[model samples]
Target chain A: MNAPATERFVVPIGPQHPALKEPGHFEFTVEGETVVDATVRLGYAHRGIEKGAEGRNWTQTLYLIERICGICSHIHSTAYAVGVEQLAEVEVPARAQAIREIICELERVHSHLLWLGVAAHDAGFDTLFMYTWRDRETVMDILETMSGNRVHYSANVLGGVKFDLTDESAVAILKGVEFLEERTHHYRKVVSEDAFFLQRTRGVGTMTHAEALALGVVGPTARASGVARDVRLDAPYVAYADFPARIQLLTAGDLEARFLARLDELLDSFRLIRVLVAGLPAGELTAKRMPRKLKPGEVISRVEAPRGELFYYIRSTGGEQPDRVKVRTPTLCNMGSVITQTIGHNLADVPMILVGIDPCFSCNDRAVTVRRAGDDNGRAWAWADLRRYGIDYYRRIRN
Target chain B: MDTITTQSPPRWRTMLDRLRNWSLANSPWLVHYNSGSCNGCDIEILATLTPRYDLERLGVKLQGSPRHADVLVCTGPVTRQSADRLRRIYDQMPEPKFVVAVGACSISGGAFRGCYNILGGVDEVIPVDVYVPGCAPRPEAIIHGVAVLLKKLQPDRAEEIDRLLVEAGAVVGEEEGIDEPNAELLGAR
Candidate 1:
């Protein structure tokens, strides 16, 4: 019996492709329209954020980490602050914790809304994109009213929040919630019944629960596949420990399921925000005993962003500045399953599959380049070239 | 052959139409590029797009492609490895482009200055039209800065170009105190 011959062709997704908003390279090996394999090569937007954090004080580091991902800014700051607080053993006020939770949930609303719009845009559903984003403003306005800014709210401080919400802000939040509820329901209908969206998303990028668990997929990506793992529920931190998190799960592991799961989570976040707001504890917004200096210690903290689990590890050397800071974003885990799921899918469905993970390239890659001579060429290299280079390097090591 | 006496629109109408066209042309589609920063400006930029600020209502669209974008909203200081890629993206956009530097780090490297691999602000590599000042400028301020830049795009503002140049630190005559050594290095490059 003769073995069948394998044919390979390369397809490049982007550094500036229409499907992606960020800069990164993804090369797919294809036989016909089916992707045989995929490889992601990032470092396009590396900005040395970790290295830069080394010299900044604990106060400055909070602001720095918040800039890791625009959509996940609150989680980044929350995780960093929690880690630093653990190192210093500083007890945050109850009111501060509740406020943080409220802000975190509000951040989730904005992020999911943004993702909803982007997902719609990816599939050429421009109207849905417009509608979703138009509603997204209400959430941003709510956040801006609470915090001075919309994106990097700068709400989180070393010990607590920099500002407190007034009674009027609470009323504004209630009004926003009423608007969000109606808009979210409309979005839910579109996600479910919109014929074009269903055709584009349904049965595309299907991931089995086992595959997701095996691949270490996290957040909605994993939850949509029936693996009920949520950091907020599992390892409760901040105010989440006090407030019960009802994890939403879906058995269908298709794009629709993932979309539904995110929408459901967004609605749940609205409920969580309202709960925190109604039960607004009266106390200091900051820890009165927060020390100016951080003691020598290392700590790790994890929080659930809209995307998934966000991990932060920090080491303080009894100095004003941190010795080291490491961030492992949810996208890092979610990106792994992309190659696995994208195999056997059409080229047109590629963008939808990629956006399903809501991958944040900036959070994953932040190194500065020291250009080597050979890397400066204009000639494009495919995944085959990368594979060949890897094999050659392995062979040299073996020899 | 009979002579045709038809003429173009009256001067006032022409001027009004030109004004409308100028505003339309200056209503840029923004494409955000995060070269790497903590994320402070990223959220603020997103906030500008959200309903309270509603950048789209102002005719600003957040595009996914550099080719379709009129303005590049660059956040964070450029990292060493991302420099070439950033240049590639900038080159991909069409002409008559504007780059808005968001956040203190993107304008003057903020607190991330003197790092081993940071290029210290995006303007070192790209020509920036406006600089929004803040550790991360408020979304309202970002909208204001972009509005000012759009206003500067009007043909009648040609006389104001010199003042704009000076504000952007692009004027050749000024020898004002150089803030960061990185700016000098960027100039040399």
Candidate 2:
């Protein structure tokens, strides 16, 4: 057997690692501190959601799809509903459209705050994590009050939103957003100039503007890298067509830039949310009596989920249930960039770089592994087996 | 590791045993493993630990490794590839091991009921003592469910595993009326 002399070993991070909240396996080959190569293996958390959607009826599938990712449940259900509505060719009320957009922006606020907290935790800044999470409760409280549930606020139905925002509800929501707005300004200041935080984020990891465009990354990941592309701005749908938003971008293409982009998006979301709430149209909560069965059609529903662009391709057979429901979540598109960007960074920055994508593992689980020609071992490395092998290998090396 | 020959055991041994069981119940270190979930439950589970829900106030800590965990807080259905690792994880934990299966999918395959790749709920792969059902249950619901399981653990665990199982079944009608058998009481993960 031939082997490299340097301690350039492949360190596998997860299927279940401490850094990653969701299950994802990444095998990184490192020479000392610098990462030489990286390969990500997802599907540690694949629940066959798309296949599950095929069996259930149009109505049942909406609830099922909403459960895809807890953080972005509204976006998933909204995208799916918009697709179904288009397939059915049902006219959604302006009120419903604005309501969906309202939740979408509110969700963005919660999600960005969620990302900030999680990213802070990744960098060993527990205090920052706690503060952001505590303030995030205000948004969660508003969401729960509006839709009756916290995480999976099932606000959207097929043709329109399930819940309507009353003047009182609107008042409560604006108060929450105002509180968040003031807090967001403080966070923006901290991330931009904090000495300790800047050491971990600034110039630590670089993804050039061209690399971002070449990899075809979406959401803040691409926006941070100077690609001025946002689905909301480019292809506005639902209420976005009615109430457009400012696209936030940063050209640094670094971790600090990623943080600032999300914060800027949050600020933008708060402003849009205020607009949607104030200018909320007066109409029926749902569209007029929607037909039970659709008139056979295909619709591609694209919505900006908190992470990035959530693309849902839905095909209907004119039956009750959909023929096929293919979801291409934003995390999947942004994931490739993480693999490419990690190559030149140090091992310690891996968590920061990975979290920069704000990955949702269950969304990106459809994967196939192809074995290399020379690799022959059929041993499945259970944690028990892996732990034992590690001990034995170390023992032999020492002797 | 000696069971006392005398009917009445020594005071020091009993005290130490009491301390161990109390500590175990008070600070239930959990290792959350998502066999195959949509991450609705995983994030909710994580939220349960954050400041708002403050799972730490209940003395709960989310452990990274199974061996260090007292309770296995599992989410989602048992996928074929993950079943082996799920079982392996359950095996790794030292006994009097409690498995709290969280989410509807983990409970009875929820929405992904007949999916080919899914092997149904977590119980199909490993024995689950407490079942918390929700499409993605609120963090508060999860806390209540874990409390139900921890309530059964004795001050000094006596009469081995079988008796522990009997106690788990017996205490369902207490504060949180919902138990493993009554699926009706369960909410979405």
Candidate 3:
């Protein structure tokens, strides 16, 4: 794969790289064990979502935007719904808003647990991965019980929510939340106390508090670095104003700190869910008569997604369809930190550092042709030469 | 060992079909690729592998390489950039390989249709064996779609399917000696 043992070489990790579940290519140039430079090629998952929204009407676009991420579908829809609701000047019923908040918190629990499982698996801790994913069923079940769909719950409509929390559903949710709270504590202890797990995470991929702010990282990644800028706490939209969210802060600023921050939030969600269910308001599930066409205006809607802050830039041209809808997902914003963090790291740690941002390449990819890497600086070989090289290498290894 | 009964007829040849069907149905190694989905169907596919749905118990292993996989499980609509890649992956899989297109978007470009960059569903790029329909289908729907594909793989079961399709005028073939798979049998244009 390389020439001289002493010479620096470029290793291209794919649009189909084995390490990545989603399609994203990364080029890493290494000088022996240390990585000297890195560049990422996206757009493998770009389905022209923002462009598609322009053709869809306001009501239909609600379902379209929600599919941006299966893991964070609720937050995306909530962001879009609230923005559209505001543009229409329709005030949502209090009960409907509370239902939306509870679902959002449940989504947080699901997303964090999902991220934890994948992160642990990336670190070669399959045991933790299996355990966390197994426990995630509790939340998935609760969500299914509530909304009749697991992944894209479609809980948020234009003006309000789709369903209410019945007494029976509330009781079931309380039990599920209680079970998850205990399991989350166990996972937190495992990540912190397990010596081998600690070895991989404790000081690995440490980002300075200032660097995190400079890079404009958000959500648990930012909170882990001691920056508390949660959209729910800061703006308190919808039910958040009635039920304020407590910011989960950590200052370790390492991979472990990121883990701890999300875990703390998972526990906080449990508390929030209980509060939401116990004090369930009485009103209609959806607001009456939301206007089909929004008033001519442009507004920015922000929501604290499970991953981070989801920003929706919506422009209504006094028509049924939006003039333009721009979605700036947190993964796209946090990608800067991931690329920058890859430098000065060991080649083995590249995957670990890159996934620390918990990237959803599908959410971030907007079609752009990545420049072919320029550092292949070796002699070009013909097809015959490459075949010969493969034959000789395998032959030598066999001998 | 159980004794073979000679009274009814020779029954050993039937085990050949049964054994093959059992092995094929039991262990379907899946190679998942997101052509251009929102990650909604992708995560649900992964969830199918997790304990809640446990697609593994049915012998579904998520493989990393297309060369090693028995089925190519794809999610989302096919974007222009990914259409070529999707075709290449489909070509790379071994013979008898199946393609399971999950999500409503992948089936007929449900949401992402008419987007300039999107080529629409997986079928636009490659032949799909099964279509699991949902904005993003649940894990149960995914498993059921796979089961439908696996069921058709059996030689005896395939004849039954072909007969049904022939009766419905979906596939233009007779039940006897019709080995070739017609395009219409793929379902849902």
Candidate 4:
């Protein structure tokens, strides 16, 4: 296995690879079977969503923002709505807040199950993938029945929520949660005790708490490394203050801990949903009056997405449209850990390590071009200039 | 190697061609690429393969490489960075290939139409045989899109199959033992 010190071999995966469901590129410098170094390149899924948000009004921007990540669509919209509500000084009704939390927990159930299935599939365990995805349909059904859409459930409005939880839907949700709870218990057992599955996860991609903190990982990824870093607990948003979620933590920072941590959070989500539904707040669904234009101010919204903390920075210029909108999705925070942790592991474990953070390329790929003041005579570009630049850039790419 | 001829093939050659067509029609291996989707359409496409929708029941298999795929299932609006890569993937697929644009984003850019990084839709880069339009199409709609592609694959035989189904319905109206033939015909494809 001894090779020349000067010889460096690198392996590139995706933008389009079977292992990656989304589009992203990664380069791993390997020595034989072991990875010597790793680097990542993003922006493959970048669609200029932030820039698009700036031109649209607050309400329209909310819809555009929801499409940022389909898996955590509600959380994105929730963050934006909360920020807008703050800027507008509008009070969201308690009932709407509880409903938002309920949907959020249900989304967590669907998202975690989906991730479990995909992770299992990546580890050469198709049976687990089938079983977990089959179980995931229950929550999907609940979401569809409640919100009228499967993936991008437009449940959040600016002042409050779009739909109210009826008695029938509430009962259905409780019943669905009961079934999912039992199934989750079985999955928890399988993830923790199944010996064959453990070979892929048990000690793989192990990140110490210190490394996690240094890398600044967030959400369940950080919690698995024994870091108390959930936005729901640290700074409660929506109805989390009323129906607090018990943070799920695991000391082992390996892939196994990530699995167990998400599953633990799934179980906690079930409990949280049950409590919220039982003590369902009764009030108006939205505020009485919401102004078309928000006051001139800036606000930052942070919500714990399925993956991690989703941050939104919104600036209003006392117009119908926002002056600026910037989103920082959770995948961006956890992406650095993948590069640092993959070093020294088998190259085959790269996908498993990448999936450990549940990396969403679409969520994180927000590209911004920077120009120095000294360059190009420090000329300021107009909107048309930027448009022409975009066109010329692609035309050059095509040619 | 055989040279092109205006005359029809022999009986055995014709039978072999029919078998090949049937096999290809039944098993349309798919290679999915996400140009710049929000992950909604991509995940829905995955959900179709899982147990609930069970797209595999129709003999559809998702392949890893474009060379092995008969159908290209594309989601998302084409991004500036991914447009060339997407075109390259389309080029890499074997001939007689079909593309199913699965999502509003892939069809006409949907909600992300005017984004600076987006290059409209899948059709902007490659020829699309089918388009399933939705913010994110439901699993049923995606399955239908695949079925439509399957029909397109056997355009000549589709009418014949319909005629046979109608005849089978009439025969069932007359007597029993019709179900066996219908089931066999359904399973044959």
Candidate 5:
């Protein structure tokens, strides 16, 4: 549908579009070259993960949760393990905590580099995309050598970590980190100094501090906008308490700032890895004992995922299986800002803006659809009405 | 109409068919779609294109549209919502196209086996020509899978490639069990 004179046209990208690495649907209403309005529809990658978690036992459920997002699989399982361990009242060894922190930081290096390549590809900077990804292989090799798997390392067990670092693997990791550090210096220079790349990023999709705070953005996206919110610094779960992460902040709040925020975070990650490795705690890899059944309790675990804040809520009814499990990934927090910022921009810049948030469809596709009773034509439901309807519906099911 | 039905095909028609097959076998373009993956396999598939794996050295390129692609590379199990869209993409591809189902989830719903919304595997929604196994397979494994598909595209060299794979310990058939019981259809072959 289009207006007669104004001629507003909607361009739908998704389900199988090429610019996106995952499946998502976005409708951008444009007037000539400028985008007027934008709306997003998710759930293309929804596999009923939350509902599936309810059916499996605690340990089996951990494996399923690790599949939630392959890019951030380590952080997903870390959040879950932290929460589950809290509910079980089991104390993991200090060495295990240190190893977990090291892997988390390594995963961040890989994830951020992966995002840099994908964002560069979206901006038509294929050379940067190829070079970044090529260098990303170094971190991937280190992960594979440590955990035996590249993408889903399964590094974290419920009580502790599965693999331990020896002097040899430690040396390998240091070597890889050193090489990556050099590359990071070059990439940071390119992101800030290269005039053509800056044109695509600088001052584009600028989200101010107030707008970032209002939208509830998280991670590097918010950090770029000058929001000082990081779960690792705030909560300090696992070994983060000992080896703290330095927060990278910028106030420009533009695409370039987001790139710089992640790059600067990489430098911090390299330093953190060095400190964690040098001061490797000497202890057992796992706890002495972890009960098969967890105690009846609810716990919330928050961790700084490579993207932003990753939250896991666990409620166990003193059984082998959890009663309810909920996850809120960083992409969900940053998605709103994308829609708000896309307006008043050119259609060609929409992909770059979307990639700016490094959106993950599979990680944030937990949703449900509801319609008003006896309504023939579908209409949007207000929040209050929807909440009332949910209460009544669940009550009816209980009865 | 009677003359067209009764006459044999022209020589140019046969030559053109051979030419099309040669090009399709030489440079097999791929279009990747995520039905409901966890993003593990999708990233690995992208990694194959990078310099480390260098899948393009095999003359394989990832296309942005299905119409221009010769192979449909799918990841993850088929979710109910994405089933229709997956089918539409497959329908849009040109004829003689093949589907490569990457990741254990897409091959048999892997970890998400009994999820309510999952339809179980890429083969449930579309025919899969090759299945690459792993929670997320390594990029080298993905390249091997592509080499296998390329061998299948050229039947004349299938035996030579099968011998090479066997010598390299990547046995082509009967070892890595898949649901598709056709013994000859297994492995990159």
Candidate 6:
């Protein structure tokens, strides 16, 4: 059975929804079960973070900006610190740079693990979801041992990191690494072998290389679609210059391919962390002192977050606070392609399509309300109307 | 190797079976919801399942969907817009659910307490079962919080609901505002 040729069915997936974990509205225009058009709405979680950054001093703002997104907190702080330090011409110690790299890589590990679990759940593989998260905890524990808190490590200051990795902490981290490596192997097996996962994800939500580039998709989403774009490799930031990044590229643009790409990236992060921790530099963890005032200038910083390329454009005004802090998260770019990919897919596959980008609506917050052409037919068509129409059409055709 | 049957099970039957099993074990699948916060509690919550703390041995798994998860691990102070989304997520989870407020912010807004954007704590909008107190609680503490939640999930623990209501006294009514209660006032808020 097909949708009525003259009428289009519209489905509003959120402002609140079971399939979506974050707050954002998505409206889909469907022909039968296929999504003919999709529109996303965000800003459901806007907190005036940029405005808040205006009044706070550079030091206080460091802690403030890190709270932008819990998963990407460290990178936000890193980007902010990098901007302020650049403006002040402050050189952080080599040890602190190395420490920043370690923490960033650790954050990537945890974020990817969390994403894996979420992706698995979207495909209804609850066991895989659990296993990936269980493994993710090791990375979080390592961060906690280094810094007092697990989520907001508070390790990054304007000039350098606040906490140094003691011998005990270092040993504890190495031990955790050993455990993670073993767990990752098991995850690799399960992710590959599970038939239901393969059925749900394979060839679903395919984003081709051309489409990904045109849409400005970044990070693993872009890489999964056969684009070799990684900010860490292209523009080395912090200690990224010291360690070579082994970027993982996948040719398949399917959901499974995206899942595999994230898994591969997680393994590479593990290797990078080992190198960083082993080559621990001996020096001050923070710079001697940063200038109280910044020079008036504009600087743009890009870092490869767990999701993809995270861009920060900061304009300083020779004051304690920045004049403007504009952030363009990876999800913002990746979200554009959801409509293109979800079309021609089954209704059951909608969540999989949404999750193919490892969407973090928390970071990319904006929801668009969609209005279609010709909805003024003086009739409101609910989801039930579409279902009923489909059922009746099927019965008539069979008869 | 034996090939498994590919026939789709009836939806109602499958749901009933899974529900029965889930009720018996009370296995909570957790989906970590970040509104806006420092990464402290988010990291510590992740640590709970690592080898040192290893929360998985207790049959708890972190889930991705509000639909599948029995517990929602929410970290952050509720921002104006995120409050609506958080409420939607809370509504999406299947019946007999629990929320774990795992950080000082999730429990009582922590360092960002008086900040303009923050709504203080998660419980300001939704019901919370366990509160792990720390600027960011350690992984071990997070694990402990989860264990406490698992206990509350038991079918026979109806009395715990009253305990939570009692603990969240003023806020439960209109006496206290939607701003989260402080950690010191958590047990007697």
User: Best candidate per lDDT, number?
Assistant: 5
Looking at candidate 1 chain B, the ten consecutive residues that score lowest on lDDT are B180-189
Consecutive 10-residue window with the lowest summed lDDT within model 3 chain B: B1-10
| Of 2 and 5, the candidate ranking higher by DockQ | 5
Q: Write the per-residue lDDT of candidate 1 for residues A225-326, one digit (tens) a residue.
A: 999999998999888988767899998999999999999998898888888888888999999777878888899899998889988889988998999898
Instruction: Give a tens-digit lDDT track for model 3, residues A1-399.
Output: 555656877888867655787888788888887888887767778777887899889989988888788788899899999988888989899999999999999999999999999898888898888888888988888998988988889898888888778777888899999999999999999989999988888887888899999999988899999998899988888799998889999999988999899999999999999998888789988888999887899999999988798898899989999988888889987888987887888888878777788888877886322346885556645647744865685467434
**Can you tell me which runs of candidate 3 are displaced by over 4 Å?**
A1-6, A367-399, B1-26, B155-189
Rank all candidate structures by their TM-score, best first, as comma-separated numbers.
Answer: 5, 4, 2, 3, 1, 6
Report model 6's TM-score to 2 decimal places: 0.75
Error of 1 at B11 (Å): 22
The per-candidate TM-score of the B chain, in the order shown, comes to 0.70, 0.75, 0.72, 0.74, 0.78, 0.69
Give all TM-scores, in the order shown.
Answer: 0.80, 0.86, 0.85, 0.89, 0.89, 0.75
Best-to-worst ranking by DockQ? 5, 4, 3, 2, 1, 6
Query: Between 4 and 6, whose TM-score is larger?
Result: 4
Q: What's the DockQ for every one of the candidates?
A: 0.31, 0.47, 0.51, 0.73, 0.79, 0.23
lDDT (CA) for every model shown? 0.78, 0.82, 0.81, 0.88, 0.89, 0.74
Off by over 4 Å in 1: A1-8, A366-399, B1-33, B37-73, B92-98, B134-153, B157-189
Candidate 1 scores an iRMS of: 3.2
- Relative to the unseen true structure, what is the C-alpha lDDT of residue A186 in candidate 2, on a scale of 0 to 100? 98
Task: Write candidate 2's Cα lDDT for B34-133 as tens digits.
Answer: 8888777887787777776776765689978888988888898888668887898889887557888998889988877887568999999888878887
How high a TM-score does candidate 1 get?
0.80
lDDT of 3: 0.81
Candidate 4 global CA lDDT score: 0.88
Computed on C-alpha atoms, the DockQ of candidate 4 is: 0.73
Error of 2 at A273 (Å): 0.9
Candidate 6, residues A1-399: lDDT per residue as tens digits? 655755778887765455665666777777777777777666556555666677778788887778777787898889888877887889999899889998898888888888888678778886777677766766766887898666777779989999888889889888888888788777777777778778998888888899888988999999998999998889888888888679899998888888889888878888888898888889998899888788999888888888888888888888888888877788888888886888778767988888888777667752222468777645555647744864685467434
Q: Give the alpha carbon lDDT tens digit for every residue of B1-189 in model 4.
A: 021122588877767656656777878899999999999999999998988888887779997999998889999999988999999999998766778898999988988899888899899999887888787888876876776566656777665534433442322332454465433422212
- Stretch of 10 with least lDDT, candidate 5 chain A: A390-399
- Which one wins by DockQ: 1 or 4? 4
